[model samples]
Structures are given as C-alpha cells and as structure tokens.
Target: MSIITTATALLADIAVETDRTDAVQAFVKQETILVQITTADGLQGTGYAYTIGTGGTSVLSLLQEHLLPLLVGEDARNVEALWQRLFATTRATTTGAITSLALAAVDTAVWDLRCKRAGEPLWRLAGGHRREVPVYDTEGGWLHLGTDDLVKSALAAQQAGWAGVKIKVGKPHVFEDAERLRAVREAVGPSLHIMTDANQSQTISSALQLAAALEPYDPYWLEEPMPADDLSGHARLARSTRIPVAVGESMYSIMQFRNYLEAGAASIVQVDAARIGGITPWLKVAHMAESHNVMVCPHFLMELHVSLVAAVPNGKFVEYIPQLRAVTRSEMTVRDGVALAPDEPGIGIDWDMDAIDNRRVS
Candidate 1:
C-alpha cells in the first residue's frame, strides 16, 4: 500500500498530573502539536509533540509550507528516503529543535502506519525483546516538591512498586537542593534508585558544588547540570562529579550525541523520542551509545520508549512522568516500577476521537 497520501495538524492542551507548576516550563497553558497522517488505503496514523507551547504552530508551518507538499502522494514506506528529503529540504538549518520536531511528527506517523499494517503493537514491531521496561516516577518529586512532598511522591512510587524516582535539583541555593535530595534518599533508602535533574539550571561551578554537596546521598545520575548544548561544559562537569552526567533531552541530532560521546560528556544518555527525529535516529543514538558502553535511559514518551528500550540490550530506565493520563484514550499499564509496552497496533494508542472532535480548533 502507498504511504502518506495526506497529513493534518492541530494544537492541543492536556493537563499534567502534578499541579506542580514550577517544575514544568512556564508556557504550560499553550497547546502543543498533534499530527495525523492518512495513507492511500485510507489507513491513518497519529502522533504528537509536547513542546512547551507554540511548538505546534511551528511544526504545522514547517510541514504545511515545506514538508507536506513533498510527502503527499509519496510512498510513506520510504521512511529513510523521506527523512533524507526532509532533512535536505531544511539543509540551511539542518536538524535542530524545530526541524526535528517536524520530523518527529512525520516519523511517528509512519511508524504508526507500519504497526497498523503489521497488526502489532509498536513494541512488537520494534522487536518486543522484553515485556517490561523499568520506570522511574518524575512527578513533581523535586526541590519544588518540598521535602515532605518529595518524601510523599517517593513513598508513593515505592508503594506502587516503582524501581526508582527522579528528584529535581536546581533551586536558588545549592545547599537547599542538597537537603531536599537528602530527604528523598532518607525516605527511599539506598536500594531504590534515585536520580537528580538540574534542568540546565546551574553554572558548571554551581553544578560541581551541588554534586559535591549531594554526593553523600548517592544519586543515580545527574541530568543537564548545564544546558544540553554545552558539551564541553558537561564534559568538565562529568570529570569533576562522580555522578554520571545525563544529557540529550535537548539534543536533536546524532552529531550532537556524538559530540557528547566523544567528549565523554555524559555517562547516561537520555534520548527523547520526539526530539531526536523520531524512532529512526533515536535507535541510531541507542546503538551508538551501546558501542560506547554508555547507558541509554530515554526521556519522556515512556510508552513509545518501552518498546525501544526493550529492543536494545544497553537500554536503561524510562522516565515516568504522569502527565498524559488525563487526555489519553487508554490508560498505560505500569505495574511495580516497570511499564509494559502497548500491544495494540500502530503506536498502540487510539486518540479519544470524541475528545479530539470536541477540542478541534475551528
């Protein structure tokens, strides 16, 4: 069957699980990108992007004014060829946030189509090597979460049988952030994995100081102590801190990941499925990281990532942020600390058509 006969885009807003506003980006109210593709046989695929806001509009503009014209009536099965065309089309900018986000929309749609055609879940289609992928709860369990809230969230995750929990550092004071981490460590104990993300919030010196202060608590990894693009800076921090530096949520290309890998910037790599040009390039990053003996702990889109991580031997933990529960048509099953990839064909997810119809922008 011919692929991608047509495509459409929309902007949507779904509430996050935590009323915890500080941990999320400031533009929380803005609707993000939602993309749907139709094939020649009338089969359709759907995907989305969760950029803070206005990302939906940027993706829509890029696709409609640029990529869609090229893709329409073209064989969607030619994912690699299409990727080359799209990437070449944007050669001036290459692959960055906007271009990759657009590619993510298309790449995800194509995979959805592939899954539907195969009548298997994305996980199975990606090679369902493992039924369960371990997860870590990320709900407002940070400095903003307060010591008590952090303890509550960590305890809840433990009680729910989660294998680990991620705490956010990067507050106004490094010592205060250390205290918050100490509280979480005390509550969860050492056996349970504990990770900390600085959200690109500190200077290298500050990150080093923070890492030292929190060193006693023993974090699983340190994420984005500086902006993700600061490769040299991250490498310096990696050298200084015992905590494995984890970056890549903000990175968009294999070249970017290569820079990090070559520089020894991060020990734990966190690839975002949507940010790195969809499943194709993400897998490349995973394989590359595997070769380097780096851990592949992907960022959000845990449902989609469950299959991806399970497919690779070097795959590590999947971030478990509980924001999509409200809007998704189906509930993702997460038992203990591990999540099971959706077994349904085509991304294993069906949009709440009624919700979509009601929320459709006129």
Candidate 2:
C-alpha cells in the first residue's frame, strides 16, 4: 500500500462564457481551486472546486494550509476514512461553504486516485448504473434574455435534441416571468421540457403566484424559489405546486438534504459534486435521494456531473453549462441529446496545464 507523499493546490480565475445573468446576480470569474495529490509510488490524482465569483483564495488557502497537510502521510486508498477524518476535523466550519469546498478537493483527489489504481472510470467505480445521460441547456436561458431571444434559444436547444432548457424566472412581476415562459413554451411546443429557476429570489407569496402563472406552461421543476435555510417554506411550496421543487446546489451538507427529504420538500436533488464535498458525498446524496424516491439532476460543472449522473439509478438530467473550456483541454462529449461519461481513468477532465498557468492569479 502506498502512502500519500505530496499535496498541492492552484487558484485560477476563469471568466464566464457569456453574461450569465440570473435573478440574483451575474457570474463573475470562476475562482477555480485545483488540488493535486501524488503517492510515494508515483500514482497521482487531480481534483478541483470553484467559487462562482469569490472565495477561491480562501478555499485554496484552506487546502494548502490545512486539509492537504493532513493528506501528506495518510493512506491514499482509504477514501471514505479520509473523508470522515477531514469532515470530523472541520467540525467548526460544518455546513458552511469554505470547508466543504476544501474537503471536496481532497475527497475528489483520493477518489480519483482510487479509480486510477483500480483501472476503472469514476462512473463505474461510483455506481455504474448507465453509460450515457440526458442533458438540458442553461446557457440559452438567462434572466437578461428577452422573450423573443428566450423562445429562439429554447427552440434551438429542442432542434439540437437536448432533453430540456432551463429558463430563469423571478421578475419583479410574476406576469413577466410567465410571459417569457409562455412564449418559449409556445415556440418550442410542449414536447421539450422547460425547467424554471428563481435562483432563491422569491418569497412564499411570490413563488406561489409565479407557480400559479407557470403551471400552464408545465415547467420540469421550479428551482430555488426561496432561501436554502427555509426548509419549511420549500415544503410548503412543494405541497402547493404541481411542479417539483428542485434543490441542493445551494445546499452544502448531506444532513441538509436529509432534512429536505424527511420534510418531503425536494422533488429533484441537484447534488453538486463540488458543493456536496466531492464525489464521495455526492454519491451518498444521490443514493439518499433514491431512497426518498426523488431523482437527482445536479447543477453546473456538467463535465464532472455527467458521469456521476450516469452512475446512479435515480440520476436524471445533467445541466449543460460549459465553464471549464479555458482551463481544460477537452469539451464534454455530447451526441444528439445525450452526454457520455469519460471512459478514461482519473476524474476524467483533461486539464491544460499551460492554460491553467495562464489563468492562474494566485
């Protein structure tokens, strides 16, 4: 058995491909925090996590100064045990953003190492339920886009054979959101699934009003209609609406998800690998969702989530939002409507070291 010999992390700032406006805010730079770990025997693994706009440095510092140090003499093969160790050590920051983000980096690194050692792809190693998964486009739907443009983008996605398109809601007036969705629904027709997101910008009254307005259009799910802390609100909203309440990207821990499931709040679980403390907890969340009879449709980082989604029985649609092109050498392989998991070893992303260096800011 080889012991871990080294650990390092990099901070890269990658810009959004487009404006990326939602109800809450526009995406700034992705503060990419990359983690690399190598064993005494020369086996290496790469893992990464990112902040949508800020805190990359804190996450990086946490990795370099705290988490990765713990990994220096640890067993590289004991992925779950390592995760528990990291989780237990970070009790002060439990259920917060920075600690989990740092934990995700190390947890993913070990999982990548384990997969590489086993000579198997992560999807198979994780669960291996399927090889390909369906995708939906979030790139085409932004809060800034107008009704005409929204309809055009939705139709384009439909023509391209994608399963669905997510449209941002949460306008000052619920009618405005309804109008855009109505126009898109009318143009793309009822065949294509239309997912709606409020980005946690709505209140109970407003969300219910918007839900009433959106009901006729048949949205795939209504995402983040309120604050993540409002578990009771989410439950009320879920019970009130015909649409499923999709959540978890805004959530960071498994216990939060457990509470949501126990309360019968979430209909679809968007268990982000980065936000959920990497593939280890991400899988736990997915299987947990399966037990609750809810489907998992993870948020962004489509490249990583594609394989994870394919790995589980309850996994559903993978959101297609390509933000890693500037840092990675390869794009996700999509054929017609489906995205395929990488058959290669490791975490499956081909990092362009030179590009990463070029994008490095700290």
Candidate 3:
C-alpha cells in the first residue's frame, strides 16, 4: 500500500539578499527543487533540494527526465534500496553536485512519506536523540560585513541568546581576518562560541597563517579552511591548528567524509543533507561522524537541518540561516539560543503550496 503512485517535480527560483557574501562568492539566487510523492494508500509527501544560483535547471532535468521516473511502482519505505538504485542508475554522475541534488529531492520526499506513516517527527523517528540543539547565527557573519558591523551583529546575536556567531574569514591579509575575529570575540566577551568559515576559499598556506592569527581569540572552529578536494592539505592544516577544522558543506558524497574522518582531517563534519543526497545518507554520515568522535554542525538549509541535527547525538550547532520563509507556512521555532525540531509527522516543513506555485519557475 506504500507503493509510490505518483511522482512529480517543480522548480522555485527564489531570490536571496544581494549582499550575502562568503569567502568564496556572493550568493544571488536559490534554485529550490521541490518533489512530491503520493502513495497507493493516498498519503502524500513533499521534499526539496537547493542550489546556490546556477545549475538548478540541470537538477530539475535530472529529476523530471531521469530520477523521478524510477520512483513509480516502488515502495516509498525502501529508502536505502531506492537510494542505491538511484545512485546506480546515475552512476556516471556520481561525485557531481547536480546529480546528488536531484537524488536528494526525491529521497527526502520518500522520507517525508515514511515519517507520515510512523506518526512521529523526523527528529524522533530518525533517532529520537533530542529536540533542542544549540543555535548559531551565520546571517550576521558574512565576509562583506564590516568589522564594526560584525561587532554589532555579534552583540545582536548574543543579546538574542544565540550560543554562537560564525565569522566569515579570508580577508586579503591574515591580520585583517584576525582583527574581525578579535572584534567579534571582544564584543561577545568570550562566552558565546565564535566560529569562522573560510568557505573553502583559502590555500593551505593562507589557512595556516589565518589559523595561527586567530588562535588567541579562541574560535570555536575554523571551517573549510581550504578546498574540499584537497584531503592531504586539510590533514596537514588540521595538524597545524589548535583550532578544530570543520568541512563538508561542499562535499557531495559519503566516501568523501569517510576519507576525511579516516585521515583525522576534519573535527566537525558539516554534511549538507541536500548535497549528499538526502536524509537516509544524512543519518549515515551523522552516525559515521559520531563513531569518529567528530561533531556534526551542518552548513545551511536550517529549515530541514533543525530536525536532522536533533536526530543525532553527535549533532552540534544548527547554523541559523532562514531561507524558506517566502514559501513555507511558518518559521522554525527558536528560543533562548536553542532550535526546536518540528513535531510534525511529514518531513517537518509546512510548505505553502500556493506560494510555491507562485514562485515556481518550471
């Protein structure tokens, strides 16, 4: 009765703030790929994946032309099996961003179906680990934000009871990034954790210098200090830094995490569920990270990640970046520096279908 009777895909082109810059690039638009599935028993579910700005149409094509077609007549409950099937079908596209993003859209829809059948929230059903994960503000920490503005943002986050505020590093000089971290630390007075994201924009040499300069300020973590592909370089940088190195937002697979963990290269694993396919593998990565004694503080899409983080014991901080307010019925609940995982049964998002239609691009 759980056989998937219908599967469909659509595109939502959402505009983001023009000034949201990281060390890598300024984000302009978000291409939200939404997938919906219906079971033979008449239960329905929706799931989605997102891209920064480009290649979203490619993801949509993969879904409509190839991936979504495979879901028909398949039991929606077979998460792992279906995921493997999709992976095998798209074997040529493995390690590619567009392919994984496409798979994630459908996989999350299937998860939404499973959760609905269980009558349990994803956080509890997935692991029942905990509800309230500590929250950190990344909206205030973009690299383009001025030092004075950085202080103001950090203080605002502190005043709002957030546990941490991330600062985007990678200025022209190591000292400039240090000065920004110093200002944020001074403004928050050291209790609130101050993390830094280099956005995988630095070279090994620059990362080493920046890490050394920021050590005095006691950053909670230094994230993506170099490119995600450079495993050996990351290992070397991790050895050199007293600060824990965090990575994996840009990574597209579980094997990449296996390599990082095996090498002791990254202390915090920022596995983005969308980029790594979906909730099925997301849990696998979380448990893998836990086994390695590494923390899991995922990158973005806080709407979905709040539940995922709450589902795992190794889950660390939920980065506060609200991206779905325009298309969702309500915002996620956060109070006193903690995010509460949704208690809803299906996928945890109350998507506004009309709004999604209005925003739909394809």
Pairs clashing within candidate 1: 161-336
Q: After superposing candidate 3, which stretches have Cα over 4 Å from the reference?
A: none
Deviation in Å, model 3, residue 160 alpha carbon: 1.9
**Cα miss at 131, model 1 (Å)?**
1.9
Residue-level lDDT of model 2, residues 1-362, one tens digit each, is 56999999999999889889999998997988889999998998999898999898889888888788888899999988899998888899888899889998888888889989999988899989998999999998999998888888888899999999999998888999999999999898889999999999988998889999999999999999999999999999999999999999989999999999999999999988999899999999999999999999999989899889999999999999999998788989999999999999877888898999999975
RMSD (CA, angstroms), candidate 1? 1.8
Global local distance difference test of model 3: 0.91
Candidate 2, pairs of clashing residues = none
Task: List the candidates ranked by lDDT, beginning with the highest.
Answer: 3, 2, 1
Q: Per model, how many backbone clashes are there?
A: 1, 0, 0
TM-score of each: 0.94, 0.99, 0.98
C-alpha local distance difference test of each model:
0.79, 0.91, 0.91
